[model samples]
Target: MPERIRVLHVEDNPDHALLIRRSLEREDDSLEITSAASAEEALGLLEENGFHVILSDYALGSGMSGLDFLRAVRDRGHDIPFVILTGQGNEEVASEALRMGANDYIIKRSGLLQFKRVALTIRNQRETFRARREKEEVEARYRHLVENVNAGIALARGDRFVYVNPKLCEILGYSAEELTSRPFLDFVAPASRETVAERYRKRQAGEELPSTYDVWALHKDGREICLELTASVIRDSEGISTLAVLREVTRERETERRAQRMEETLDLVFRQAGEAIFIHDLEGRIIEANPAASRLTGYTREELCSMRVQDLHVPEEREFSENKLASARLDGLFGFVGTGRCKDGTIKRCAVTTSLVRMGERTLVLSLVKEVPERMTSHEEEWVAAAVDARLKAALEKAPMVAVQAYDRQGRVTYWNRASEELYGFAREEAMGKTLYQLILEAAEAEGFLQELRRVWESCTPAPGREWLTRDREGNRRWVYSTIVPVVQGEECV
Candidate 1:
């Protein structure tokens, strides 16, 4: 669809006005011409209607002249394109009209042919007005975006800033004039000046480099600030300039550095600490273990990672350890005294402190384990020796067919008779203070045997005797029948 160009024609001569309207309508069907008898009537029509162009005669008989009408329209804040129509041989009058802000002028000639000039002039003036208004609107929007954006923006030519937005001025603690007057390099800190200068030089030389990087900037108060800058070379008719955007990253960089330092310190502590430390998931699977943990558990780092946290405790302590871990999760931190069963089946009384830690999206458990040293005074040792009846000990030592051994709840052997050692092909010294699994059972059978022992301990009943294929210290495999029963000491099962 063609655009409708509304025109207001002001002429005191009724004949000329009618001729002009007919000529314009014949010249272009899209032109809508509205007639006014004088400049006074035109001004009144302008208030009530919008127009794209105005055509008026140079002379308005007995009233205001075309120049006066132009001034009056402008004073009323109507910027409609105004064109003056003058009589033949009045080129000077038209020239004067142009100087007085009349957009253009046409000399009227005889007949309807001269009205074509008026129609052409109106179309040209309307198009020029539309283009100018669009340019002004685009420039206004660009200015608004640059001034109100959060990051500092600058346009630099050579080494100096050509333009700096309000945000840039605020960032450097300088007024617009103060920043643009000096070389941009003067505000860069010494450490980053060379790098920034090199990149700018390369960018100006048309060599492609990283468009965004970090630089240390010098604030007006002389403090160094870290800034992340993104810059691109902008080439135009005025030659080349660089458009740069700057954002402060001082706090974010500091946070990253602090976190890195903390991680390094923690890694050092984990490698050199005296006590064992273990990190595991909710399923009790070990994720990480420190060197001390490997030493404490008598397992290699690789071996520990393959085992669960419960696997490190004796069968009797499994329920207790589980409860402590649950408490740690609920309370954030918890500590307890428990027993740890080593790879060799020797048990240590341990003081364990556990805490729950959240990293990113996952929750983990951290446990610190310290062995509690066990020492018995001479009086205590003597009382323990006297507690065991001598006749029962003698009977166990002499038993030929039955191999008898006694171990604590933690699977640590309390007594190993000579007959038991003989059956397992181990001496009393080697069999004592060690669990039956470590003394005679093969590695593959250790877990299943421990489960049966746990059942007996939990139920306080004798586990059905079963035939077991086991290995000894010499790696000899032998078949034997074994059973486990919890001992009752008063009302409690030990």
Candidate 2:
């Protein structure tokens, strides 16, 4: 804007050069451009003065091409913006020019808009290069820090080790030469191979995973050394790589094995756990049903396997079950205290918990069911209900600006208060036990809320409140804040 940009243009064609100069001049009067008929002339002119930008035709009349001119400029330590003007726009040729450090490119026939675009792109590229240089400096410092750290550090690509630090080589009882050429998975014990693979797959898929896991590495003496490995993935434009830090955990592994033995010895204590355990896919198709589940449902394992969760619930409860299943698709698990109709047509009070199990790219749900005792006193039942109601009410009360509601472990309307009724424009009777997720127009948002709740429940901790907007009866979206807390009844936490 002050003195105009100074641009040096090298073109063998007089007509094309004149057209480009006219276009640039028309675009901004602030442009002061000079033209050279050959790369030789451009080089001679550049020795006397600095130019803000350089535009060169890819195919010059002279033997030297634009790429050669670019290399020459770079060899001389010049960092001016360089744009390539080509008659033919081939992807391979364009890529080559770019790789050779061209700032931007445009086909001669592309019109004035492309030239303007190239100019803007050149300005942005300069800024980006500066930022990238700074990032590289920081990364170099970080690499230095990691190199000198005492912990064993090894870098790997997929299962193959690429680099191993001295400390890690010592811990593994192998020289760097022996470790770098081996498949990292070869050192992991067979028992832990699946876990390591799962973690690696997650990292490759761009998931940030915690790096602590148990593994066995082969020592120089060919002995299996149990170790605790902490690892992370380093990702760049190319692909994902692994960085693992190892610690000796032979003693911890021994302790774990002893604890496992003790647990096996005490397995008989839970042989009569009364609770029915059932595992199902996300679609609610029964996959595994324990003896207790078969007895409680009045269905044999063979019969249960063929039945969907919706088939077990009454027609009214079927909708509820489907809604919960859909919610579980988004949230990891869905739990409810509902009455499940047994094969003999009797309804049993049961608590059900369903969790999403991810195997590879597929997800399934595992459900556990426990039958509640019928001999409970009114005081006990009331206490349980009151506790659940109080928590649900408190969640709503705390969310003054937005409505809050909760579905019971059974997918029933367990708590619907004044704010929920007013905000949703639905009466308590209309909303209660109506399948909250399906009833809300913003099903996706409701799904998010449930997912957060499931995470908390699974981790046995308080979950963060999720803010969402739900459609009221009038189809107006009203904001909502929802949180779920598990209510423990007797020895079971629902």
Candidate 3:
């Protein structure tokens, strides 16, 4: 059901009041009428009851007239719509009532037409008041929201500050009165002023660009602040203006710059380092090769990056390289001596240190390959070495009882089989490239051992088996029967 309108009807004559009520109810039954013969009685009823509309006599019998009553209600901030009634149906009196803030006015007549007209005026008055009140409430809430929001909001005409919210004033450290009538670019840092102006000019010229970006701004105290500003062009009745929302991004932007600087530093180190570094993905495809790595392989950096780890391995070492890579993925770190094919189709020897590393979301391998002296003289020599290496690998892994070892011409242990590891109490990996006699003989026995080794090398003869005392890895003296034989490689004892 529709809500009934509450109306206060004020008139001096009882007959006129009855005529107005009966005529109004006959046409529309929605009006709930209350009687007041004088403005004084109407004021009392107004204090107690909330009426949506009010009808009053133009001239009251007591107290003030209807126009005076309307002024009083408005002065007291009452939200009731008051209409006036005149006995003579004169336009002059109706005009005077409306001029004094009466929502509407009606002229008394002998027929019921005046009653219907007054009912319509009351309905119109109620609707207009309700709409006006709601509009005011919405504006109040909007003003509060803009004032308290964190993002700074501002309006500009050309370069001048036209309007700014409280948040904008707070951000700039200025009062609204101080900021208004000032050039907006005055707050921009000197270094960023031209860039800001150019963007604004392009926007006004209808050119498309980024609507939001970072810029440097200045505070009232002359501190430089980074601002991320989003702006748009607004064409209003007055002219074209710019509306902007900005926030401080100093911390966030500086963090990004610091991260970029760190990346640059790391890249510089990688390019300038002495170690050969190759970075590849989990699938063995080379992603990056440092200058040292490229130089050692006799390939340009771009050429090396386009090749896979296996591509650089010598044909015979390809399987070994691939298997080592797969094993490194599981172990995270691995190393092995590999014969690689260089760019000029020559054999290059290197010991590669490979490790798995994580960069952001991708898994990669970072390898450091150090070049070792080439021992093979030709392809035929390499094939012979490869075959010997195969048998040597089996003996190192499967035969721990027979101590088989090899030494270079410099008297450094090049290969230590598994049997040597068990007999000497030092793993093969720990004994490679170490001076043989120093690792096994004590200081007191070192001189005699060197004399014996030199004699065996020069004589090309095998020394008789002799019981000798040697030190283990723990420096404990132990007894073993040892024979020395001169091993020759390429006309040299090795």
Candidate 1: the clashing residue pairs are none
Which ranges in model 1 have alpha carbons more than 4 Å from their true place? Answer: 87-95, 109-114, 298-303, 342-348, 374-494
CA lDDT of 313 in candidate 2? 75
Across 180-253, the per-residue lDDT of candidate 3 in tens digits comes to 86798888999999999999999988999899998898888888989999999999799899888999887667
Please tell me which predicted candidate would have the highest TM-score against the true structure.
Answer: 1
CA lDDT of every candidate: 0.81, 0.71, 0.78
Candidate 3 overall Cα lDDT vs. reference? 0.78
lDDT of 2 by residue, 371-481 (tens): 666566667655544443343244346443345566654445666777777777788778877666757746676566666656655664445434456787878865444
lDDT of 1 by residue, 1-494 (tens): 98899999999999978877887899988899999998999999999998999989889998998889998988888888999888888989888888878898887777666767777788889999999999999999999999999999999998799999998888888899989899999999999999999999899899989899999999999889899999999999999999999998876676566457656866776788787989998778999999999899999999999988989988998987787666655554445566789999898876666656655567788777777655656565444334322423453476454577776667667777876777778888877778767778766687777787778778865677566777766788766666675554433556
TM-scores of the candidates are: 0.69, 0.36, 0.61
The true-versus-predicted C-alpha distance at residue 390 of model 3, in Å, is: 31
* Clash totals in order: 0, 7, 0
Which is better, 1 or 3, measured by TM-score?
1
Worst 10 residues of 3 by lDDT: 387-396
Better of 1 and 2 by TM-score: 1
